[model samples]
Target: MNKRLLSLLICLCLFISVFAGCSDEDTKKETEETTNEITSETSGKTEPVVERGTLKSFGIVPDDYVSFSAKMFDILGLDTKEDIYVYNVPQEAKVIYIEAYSFDGSGWKNVWDSGAGITAPSHMSGEIAIEIKKDYSLKISGDYFSSTTKPLTLSENIENVTVLKLDDFWEFELDKEVPVYMILADEEKNEFSYNLEDYPSTENLDGVDIAQVLTIEFSSEPL
Candidate 1:
């Protein structure tokens, strides 16, 4: 009986030893997995950073801004209200050139713009432009307007056109009635215009396209 008891004790000790070894292995694996997870988290935090931008415009609007938009039609002998101007804000990484041409009302002509230098904290570097031109007049003498004064003229091609974000235009106020012409050109020089009309409106502009609003004329004539 004494020898049998001693044999049982030996068996129990061996079983405990095997279980303890397995537990140790499991603990080690858990620790390794935890360390790997921490390393991955740290790497994610240090990823590369890139800059972002919002809607933007050229300001201070040149002192002659209004006059410039109107002159586009005068040169063509067209006494019409089709005047356009274009400008852009380029991303530091992608800007090649910027230009502007306008007729504010008095006459028609072209103006070379090296471009305006304005900055907005919320705006990233990108290109956007504007155009205004005169529409068809009743008399033939007034019918043929300047290239830019033609209703719906694009200073830049569609792919080259610049777009604006709502946040970007909030930085400036509409001091006067302004016609914001966002135009696009096709292969035959055909162009389309979207209005970002500013001043005297009581509609929701939240998330609205400023370019689209400017091109549409609201009729007060009443339907």
Candidate 2:
């Protein structure tokens, strides 16, 4: 009887030891997994920085509007009413100029120039509203001013056309009823003009490739 009791106690001790060993191993594995997760969450993943003088380009489709703050327009010497300019610029352009152009059936003519010498900020870059008039393309020249404005064609075409949000004009209240000209252009570079007072109603510009747009001559009197 004594021998059997001793044998039973030994078997119980062995089972308890094996169970404890398995529990310890599981705990250790769980701890290791948690540690790995924490390490991954707090480890090295950073964004690369862009150097100055790097050239970049952006595209704007009709009906889509971009936004920029008033301070930036101030640097460009523009008195934007909505306190926002409808265009995108380089985060840090060495030189920047916004111009309005009219594409005659033959060539593009400069209508308004938003004098250059404006540099953009890296962190808080503003937005641009893409609005195009009938035959106008807003030309933003700077950064690679000479090259970018050069048309995308290898045929030595030079036309960096951009559009603006029309709401920018509708919301723009002048000191008086000013004579404004809305310039619009199309894909073939054909240009046209419209009077701001008789502004055309905004239409669903779905299949319209209206290039750049600009509003020139906000005059208290007639232009």
Candidate 3:
């Protein structure tokens, strides 16, 4: 009695299903296109906030000159080229080395560390110095002197040790040659005494801020 009507109704239902599926497909395509656009724009336009390996900001030395050097771990001296430069090394450096240098055709030197694992007969130097800059996540090892690093902060003075708390270490290194000049010069005529190879005039310059410099190099094994 209603075969034709029923067949027409079935066709209408199929049409509705197909149209709904097509609508869903169109919606999915639009969503995918929008996601791709956002991804492309973000990849092409965004930039990083900071440089890759930059650690932190350093302050100005007394003069315009910048010097790197080693130090005795026990003493912390502000005497540039006179006192040793020091870096509170982290514990992560397994095989780190510390070294020193000089300017104006000077020379090279190696500093010391207390972690050399040496148990000297009660008379050896007991100063423990360090050269590496240490963050909170690093550690120090017993074999600190086996590093190929050259720039180090060296000092044997037991009074001014930098306390690096990350690895429970108090590394102390000493400068081979005491610094004699200021690396940085600001027109203030800052006067400091340093040891030079030969004896020159002891009078301080009037205008230029002179600092005897000590170059400390630091290096470590590959991670």
Q: Best by TM-score, which number?
A: 2
Q: What are the per-residue Cα lDDT tens digits for candidate 2 across 117-185? A: 333354112333332223332233223232112222212342323333433222223222222224333
Residue runs of model 2 more than 4 Å from their true location after superposition = 1-92, 120-124, 127-212, 215-223
**lDDT tens string, model 1, 141-192?**
1111212223333443333333321221221222222333332223332232
Which is the better candidate, 1 or 3, if ranked by lDDT? 1
Give the residue spans of candidate 3 off by over 4 A: 43-223
In model 3, what lDDT does residue 172 have?
Answer: 24
* Local distance difference test values of all predictions, in order: 0.33, 0.37, 0.31
10 residues in a row with least lDDT, candidate 2:
55-64
Q: Give me the runs in candidate 1 sitting further than 4 Å from their true place.
A: 45-223
lDDT of 3 by residue, 97-181 (tens): 3223223223222232212322323212111222333221112222224232233223333122221111111132332222222
> Best lDDT goes to which candidate?
2
